[model samples]
Target: MNLLHAYVSGRVQGVYFRGWTRGHAQRLGLHGWVRNLRDGRVEVLASGPDNALRELQELLYEGPALSRVDGVEIVAMADEEQPTHGFSIAPTV
Candidate 1:
């Protein structure tokens, strides 16, 4: 398994980014959550098979049709920090 912690920047807020992230995460059988940051970025944390996580990372770059994703900064997380189950869209923080 692999865990990914990412911050997606650029025109990501107010564009259904969280919703689209949750949907894609769930479809990929990833566990964790996505939320909007006060700094106009979108934050995502997901854990799953390495292949699945890689696929999801690709999708994050494109996001929804309305979003203009400038960049995605991703980091690998230790297994202890990875969420165990389910994907969700979290409240803005």
Candidate 2:
């Protein structure tokens, strides 16, 4: 399994980014949560098989058809951990 944390930046918020992310993650059988950051980026933490995790990152680039993702910063989470039961759109922190 692979765990990843990504920050997707651009015109991402208020454009169904979180919703699309959750839906896509669910479809890809990934587990984690996505939320909007106060700084206008969308942050996501996902854990799954390596392929699934990599696919999720690709989806973040063209989020929601409404989003304009300028860039994404991805980091591998060294500590392997199982995520929650399902993907979700977490409340902004």
Candidate 3:
């Protein structure tokens, strides 16, 4: 299993990025959450098979066609400890 945390920048807010991310993550059978950061970025944490996680990250770049994703910063999350079950959209932070 693999877990990843991704922060998507550039016009990510107010564009359904979080919702879209949740759908994609769910489709990929990933667990974790997505939320809007105060700094106007979409923050997502996804855990699943390595291949699925990679596919989900790639999908984030397009982002429901309404988003203008300029950059994506990803890092491995090793402290989660426990596995996630399903994807969700979290309240803005």
Candidate 4:
């Protein structure tokens, strides 16, 4: 198992990015959260198989149709990030 932490920027906010992310993550059998950042970015944290994590990163780059993803900055998370059971939309931070 692995975790994926990504900060997606550029036209990411105000779109259905979080919803889309949650849907995809669930379909990929990942457990995670997606939220909007105050700085016009979307933050996603997912835990699943390594391949699923990588796939989520790619999907982050190609967000919802209304989104124009300019960049996705990936970060490594500590094992303690804590994996929950299901994907959901986290409150914006």
Top of the candidates by TM-score:
4
> Which segments of model 1 are wrong by more than 4 Å?
none
Best by lDDT: 1
What Cα-based lDDT does every candidate model obtain? 0.92, 0.88, 0.85, 0.91
Model 4 lDDT, full chain set: 0.91
Clashes of 1: 0
Candidate 2 lDDT over residue span 1-93, tens digit each? 678799999999999999889888999998899999999999999988889888998888888877899999997666745585889888897
- Rank the candidate models, highest lDDT first: 1, 4, 2, 3
Candidate 3 residues 7-88, lDDT tens each?
Answer: 9999988888888888888888888899999999888888888899889989888887778999999976676553567778
Worst 10-residue stretch by lDDT in candidate 3?
76-85
**Ordered list by TM-score, greatest first:** 4, 1, 2, 3
Candidate 1 per-residue lDDT over residues 1-93, each given as its tens digit: 778899999999988999999999999999999999999999999999999999999999999999999999997667789898799888889
The positional error of residue 21 in candidate 2, measured at the CA in angstroms, is: 0.5
Q: Give the TM-score of candidate 3.
A: 0.91
For model 4, residues 1-93, the per-residue Cα lDDT tens digits are 888988999998888999999999999999989999999899999999989888888889899999999999988779888577999999998
Q: How far off is residue 43 in model 1, in Å? A: 0.6
Residue-pair clashes per candidate, as listed? Answer: 0, 0, 0, 0
